[model samples]
Target: MNLPSLRATERFANQMILDACRGAKRVHIVDYGILYGDQWPSLIKALSERAEGPPLLKITGIDFPSLVNLEKTGNRLVDYAKSCGMHLEFHSIATAAWESAQPRYHLFSELLFVNCQLRMRHIREDGIIDSPRKLFLEKILSFKPVMFFQSVVHADIGSPFFIHRFDGAWRSFLARLESFEETMKLELIDQSQLDFMDKFIEKCAMGAIACDGQNRVERISSYKTWDRLARKGQFGQLPVSKRALEMVMSVWSGHENFTYGMDENWLLLGWKDVVLNALSVWEPIEKLPRFKHQ
Candidate 1:
């Protein structure tokens, strides 16, 4: 959640989305499923220096509060917004609250269901609950934000969790993209610009790659979840670090047969389109695009 550099690749896509809507007087940033506002300071810092007309930023971060971490990061952002002179607001809504407030406040979800981790729990209680899926899609189609950008987990479609539904394979998982595309039904704006897989490959090939003694890298990925990768060892293998390994352990810990291509393995799936938006494929980050004000 702590993107060391506010302008780096890991955080670039989300930043680009906000930057695209920079001219709006009241920018409603809806962070529903995942709430990590620690990223706000870096964003506010980056935005304050922009040459465009400064919009009176009205920020709203929505979330399933009980399920996620909101306090620390939210407090930090509230403070940052006040300091930057941006009009601020926060809406912490849960599913039950959403049901009651559906009369007025908009209820929306910009997610592909496989990512929700809600497929099973609902079915257990209702014995065959398809209503929420429709609700999920309905909210999205209805809200139709001015500038919409979201990451839907599309790997291993029909995951073991939904084996009966997705059939479970990388191809099956990616196939959902088409169904999702047909669902939300947005203005097809190809806004991709970062070659994450190629960059990872290049980073792995170059001396930029780093690894631990056992050749494993301890990675705390986007969800702040812990991952342990270790190389071949004397009887078995040993983790490089008890917690998180540094850069040295990352190089060799990467997938050896990692094929960085145009296919699904690519981290930033829409990099090609975004780069097309920038009108050129850049080395890492896409050069900023000029978004028209609404």
Candidate 2:
């Protein structure tokens, strides 16, 4: 998909990953929902051109077993890495649930990075005592990655209440439609492309409004809710790096409607007033020692 917001978010994330892996000899990246592995080629190219040479890169792609062809994706990446003359290892973990793949992640001494882009919201948030969302976050935290990067759409459509969810989903659907319209006006979008965008937005709207319980796949939450969840899971937010900011701006130089800003530590990318996506970096907080009670 050539959506401006999606492209912008991916670019921003690639920059952050490149910056984070600056001096590492061996780097391991765990990518959630690594659909077609589109984000890595640029990072691979940059890493290969590094002054000290590219690190021994290992990427573990996790996704639903039925949704992706892991072997095909890995082969493509391996071929691309070979073309760049960079040594790379690709691992694939296919599972129905995110937390279930925890034991399968092959951790090594490499500096670790976890990338979750528009994927976490799909994990059900219904369980009061032990929600899947919380378990997934805890699993990521357990990895103790050097950097954890995530990008999510900022909306309140995840609410369980039908009325509230409908309101949020309606507004979100409109904002996305408006963005596409505005983008088409500024740039030349073909009829087919426009139709595809419409279908994508429609799917999301239907999922949010039509489906209920586990059936609702498009469960989006606000950035604030994500922040609370991350903190509760003992993760500390990191400020957006200046280099990442510059890279995003440079990519978006010509587009006036697409804007980027920082909300505390988050890097917010929006179309006009409606924030479409929010990207943030996080790290596991160290456990404090407890003195014996006297």
Candidate 3:
């Protein structure tokens, strides 16, 4: 099933990334939580079809060490780029924590973009000087990417109290399940596929409720919280372009239950009344010196 919110996020993100890299000779993308590398194939195709010819592309995918085989993911992306006749390089960084992962900065030249999708919340947000999320954001800012795009599930499911967290998770899960059910009803789906989706959602619900302390993975925060965090980190929010907004609207044009809107500079996607996800773009607050790779 094509999840409307996910598809909309991908479409909006790719459009922005393409626009940022237009006319650049070399482009580097640092992707956080690049599971399966599903978002890059369409981007590679778009680059290949560029009128001025595709730029040399380099992607550095960062994720937990045990979560995925980085080498395999890199190979798959490399092979896909080759098929498109685009020169590409893929680097994989596997670390226990995002704050500790150090990417090769010397390789970045010309255009640099960072893509963080539904993953930052996984970094422990304990109120401490060594907060992983803060350090991670600082690291990204240090890279001085032209544009930093973040898509996060906006839910108050990361509260410290179990009862509050459980209540938030339950409500968010129900909303997501309802949206999935409505979508499935519109599309002709077989029982086997239905069973698979059921399992998938159930697993996510269990993870959100039963786990805690480093073990709990789905630590989602509200968009307001993210907004404060980004501003506190000395990043300036960028407005979503008119074309990008229209493109996202077209993705959900036929789905009456789906809704889209903007909160400040962030673009939001929702199912009915419950806001599910948010996409925000940012750049460094102070201009930094640009260095090309030697």
Tell me the alpha-carbon RMSD of every candidate. 18.4, 4.7, 2.2
lDDT of each: 0.31, 0.81, 0.82
Compute each candidate's TM-score over C-alphas.
0.44, 0.92, 0.93
Which segments of candidate 2 are over 4 A away from where they belong? 103-108, 184-187, 287-294
Compute the lDDT for candidate 2: 0.81
Name the candidate that leads on TM-score.
Answer: 3
Q: Identify the superior model by TM-score, candidate 1 or candidate 3.
A: 3
**Model 2 Cα lDDT, one tens digit per residue, 75-142:** 99999999999988999988868876763343455677888887877778888678888988888888
lDDT of 1: 0.31
- Rank order (by lDDT, best first): 3, 2, 1
Ranking by TM-score: 3, 2, 1
- Per-residue lDDT for 109-157 in model 3, tens only? 5588888887777777876787888888888888888888888888887
Q: Is candidate 1 or candidate 3 better by lDDT?
A: 3
lDDT of 1 by residue, 14-37 (tens): 344444445544344544443556
